[model samples]
Every structure is written in structure tokens, then in C-alpha cells.
Target: MIRQRITATTDPAAVHPGLAEHQSDMIRRCPYLGPSVDRGLTVWSAYDAEPGDQPGLFALLVETAEELRTARRESGPLACRNIAILDPEDSESARKIMQWPAWLARNLYAPVQLMVGRFWTGVELDDSKGRAMMPPPVSFFSLRNAIPSKDGLFLSEKLPEIMAILEQGPGDDGRDVFAEPLGRRVDDPASVYRELKGLFPPPSLATAG
Candidate 1:
């Protein structure tokens, strides 16, 4: 799952200047303006989860935005600036990037499938319609394409090492590691795979002639 955080200026003037102009351009290009525009900066983030669990991400985004809005109302308008918390390749840098985005979209928007391949390599969709719908020249991550490690700790290529870090027992850190609770005990990869199969069933076999 890739997480994104977006921040933008509270001042109306500082909001994306070209956005209003683009609105007119879009109207000219397509007469259908499906929704009313509310002027605010919005941040977003996403995670990989079963389709059933997407509501939680949306809820989190909404709650964060409401909290920030309430804080600004009570204290005063915030300083004009935008910051995004992105995954840093290193531990120390990652910690520094943990701050929340101010305004967030209520909708839990997934990456426009065009961008999904950039992070998720070897991803195969079960549906033919889905494969056909994908944007052309799909980009993906590879060891050769990865950004160089600043800390000289090249764990990115080490899946076992990464998994170990992920599976570290609780009380080590409060950070939510698993998106959903696991039913099977740790070290049980087969059980995990079985559970996943239940959640994400294989495409049915084609009928024999």
C-alpha cells in the first residue's frame, strides 16, 4: 500500500491558482460539470486492502480533515504552506515525514490505475476488462530503478529482511503494521495464504469444450 499526504494553503488566494482557470477550460471542453466545486486544499492517502475495507480509509481521511479544520477555527487560520508526508527510504527520515495533511478529500481515491504499476510490480488483475482498461506503457518498480539508499542499508532488495521487520512482535512499536488483524499465529505463511484465498478467490476455470 502506498500512503500519500497532501497539504495546501488555507488562504483562498493561495489555493491552486490555475485550478479555477482550468475549471473554465474543462467547462469549455466538456459541458458536464458533475459536481459543485468547494474551494479547499485536499490531501489523500491509500492502502492495499480488500474492497470491503475501503470505508475505513475514507473515514480516517474525513476525521483528519475535520480535526484540522476545528483546530484552525479555534486557534486561528494556519500558516500558508503545503507539506506531504511520503515514505522515506530510511528509518530516521521516515519518522520525520509522519506529520498529517491538513485538508483531505472525503473520497478515498485510489491511484488512477495508470500509476499503480509504478509501485506494484508483477501485479496481475483477474478480470480481462480490468487488464484492458489499464493505461498503456504501464510503469513498475525494479531493483535497477530504485532510488539509491542514503543510509547504505539496502533492505529494499531484501524481502526476508523486510518481512522480518514487518513481523516484529507488538510492543516494539505502536505503529499499526497489519491493516487487519491476523487470525493465524506468526510464522504461519501457509495459513496466511489460505486466509488470503478466502478473501481473494481465484478466477473460475474456463469450461472444457
Candidate 2:
């Protein structure tokens, strides 16, 4: 499985190196995610100013690329999973909040699989504005019990379908799932910058230095 975490820190190059090393060591010690595979999971860290913009919130990105490669070498059907760990300090609703408009427009649609963890249970968002107003820690633990069993169709069947939706490439159906305005056109960087400036003003000159 590919498991990852998302963070909102400004400097991933500095923070990720240490965190990745620690996580790698942890995975090496883990019984389930370790022995089943050779080498270890690939780890990557990325930063986005708009999403979960806070330091100390770490995201781990894990992929099954190596396992897939090994499976092909052994002439076996690919069997792996991708999982992303979202820090509770980071908001889940905020992750895809921008996609809400396109989802409503029917220009694009996709399912996101979430492993209910301590982070999910504490989610408290205002239904009216879709804003998270409170921090709920227990919400994460509740998800542990709610997750579908590994033997069930939920993970095998539903997960693949959801992945397909997420895999839709850019320009498919004149839509970019990762696009800020969802289905709308603002393809060029200049246009994107202009749009973003309206929503988020440029950092003051005093703060720039």
C-alpha cells in the first residue's frame, strides 16, 4: 500500500530529510509494513501554501512502486496499497475544500479513501460554511473501529475505483481535478497568480525579507 502524510510547512527540504529518516527507521521496525516487502516504502514531502499552512504538521507520502516493480519481476499481478496519513493539526476538509465547486458542477467527481484515524473523529466543521471551527482529537481514535475490514470489498473494490477517479489526468474532459477553481479555466501561471492574489494578497514587502 502507498501511505503518505501531508504537511503545510514552508520548508520541506529541511524538515522532510529528518522526518523521512525517522519514518524510514520506524517502518524498518514495523512488523506488518516491513517484512512483507524488501527495501522500504518511498517517502516524499511537499508543501503548499494554501493547504494546511502550518509548521510542525508533517505529511508522509508512501507509494508501492517498489512492490509493483518486484511483482512484475516475479510475474505476479500487482498487489499493493497506497495510504496517506493526515496530521490532525492539518484539516481533512481543507485538503479538498477547493474541489467542492467542481463536484457540485458535475464537471468532475471522485472518491477519496480515508483510513479513519484519530484525526478523522475529531473533525468538526460548520455545515453551513464548511469551516473547521474546533479541534477534535477523539475523532481520530473513533475511525480505528469504523474502518472496513481488510478482507472486505471496501478496500479491494472501492479503493481501486476511487484511485481511478483520482488518476484522471489533467485536461481530461476539459477539467483539472487539481486545479484551484476545480473545473474552471485558469490554466496559465499568470492567470493563476492573478486569481490567487485576489484571494491571498502578496506578502508585504517588510515580510518578504
Candidate 3:
């Protein structure tokens, strides 16, 4: 199974020097996320209009080229409509937000404000030369909505409410927050994001005519 590696940075030049001049080579050298092998490069970068400040960026290295193609096919017209142009600043933001428990804590309270992101994907070579040096192409989608956001409450105020809610039982309000059957709740990494952040419901699959 392939997974994406997300990172955040305040400075891209420091992290990956000469990024502007050597986009492809430099990007390929970015640290490998883990045991999972990434197939294609899909990147998104979001920027703020305020000067002297950096834009938040995110990069998504998907599982396989074939898998990415399948994703586009499933996307239908969405693939054409949703694309973005990525820059260094945007890369840094993505790296920062992925910093583990701290990110969870911060986002649980006040959600960070963000604009729609520009999307990108790698373009595999079409010739017999193979995919030695592929170019990244820009595309757009409303993927920003899929990203989790802050819930607009101070940490101090939110913790107690969350704790209290966790303690409640079906007897309290006739609603079972823990109603899933034991077997049904077994470890599902696929739903982990939904479990953790509770945002960005899965895309709606199109129905056959």
C-alpha cells in the first residue's frame, strides 16, 4: 500500500536549495516518507496575500502512477476543474502542519485560515524513453474542503466539552457515540483521518445513469 508523505517548512531554500532552477531533480530528492513507495508527485500550495509572509504549502506523493490515473478517471470533470500551482512557501506550510500531536491539539481548537490550494501532478513520459524525467502538470479541484480545519474554540474551553461528551452514554441522551459494533470498529487505517479530525467526508461516488 502506498501513502503520501506531508511536510511543512518555513524556508524552502534552506531545505531544498536551487528549488526554482531544478524543480524536478530537487523534488525527487525529498526524503522518502517511509516503507511505502510513492508512484507519482501531486503537490498543492496555498498562499496568503500578505507580503513578507510565506504561503502554506502541501505536497502529496501518491501511491502509483496507475493509481493516480485511476483517481483522475474516477474524478470525472473534477480533475479538469481542480488544479493548482505550487511554490516553495506553500511547501513549507504543509511540512509544518504535519508535526504530530501538536498539530492535532492546535487544530482541535481554532482552525487555521486558508485559501483554496493550487494542485499539481506528475506527467509520465508518453514515449519509449520511459518515466526517467517526467514533468509535473497543474490541475485543480476543491480539495481544500477535504483538508481538516480548526473548530474556533480555545483549547481550554474545548477540552472540557470534549471530555464531557466522551463520558456521556446512550442513557444520557439516547444517542450512542460509541454505537459501532466491536468487530465493525476494528483497526481501519482508511478511516483514520475521519476518526482523528472528523473533517472532509469521503468524496461522493457518482451513480450510474
Among all candidates shown, the one with the greatest lDDT: 2
Segments in model 2 whose C-alpha atoms lie over 4 Å from true places: 1-32, 36-38, 51-95, 98-209
Per-candidate TM-scores read 0.20, 0.25, 0.19
* Candidate 3 lDDT by residue in tens digits, 144-174: 1111122113212424333332233222122
Candidate 2: Cα lDDT at 150: 33
* Backbone clashes in model 1, listed as residue pairs: none
Model 2 earns a TM-score of 0.25
**Considering every candidate listed, which one attains the maximal TM-score?**
2
Q: Where is model 3 more than 4 Å wrong at Cα?
A: 1-19, 26-45, 48-71, 74-95, 100-209
- Model 1 stretches astray by more than 4 angstroms: 9-53, 75-209
lDDT, candidates in the order shown = 0.25, 0.29, 0.26
Expressed as tens digits, the lDDT of each residue in 1-209 for candidate 1 is: 33433333332223333333433432343222212122232222222222222233323333443344444344333201122222333333322222111001200111100000122212232221122222111111101111112212322332223223323323212222123434333342322333433443323211110
- Superpose all Cα atoms of candidate 3 onto the true structure and report the RMSD in Å to 1 decimal: 18.3
**Model 2 C-alpha lDDT per residue in residues 41-89, reported as the tens digit of each score:** 3223332223332111111110122233343345322222222233323
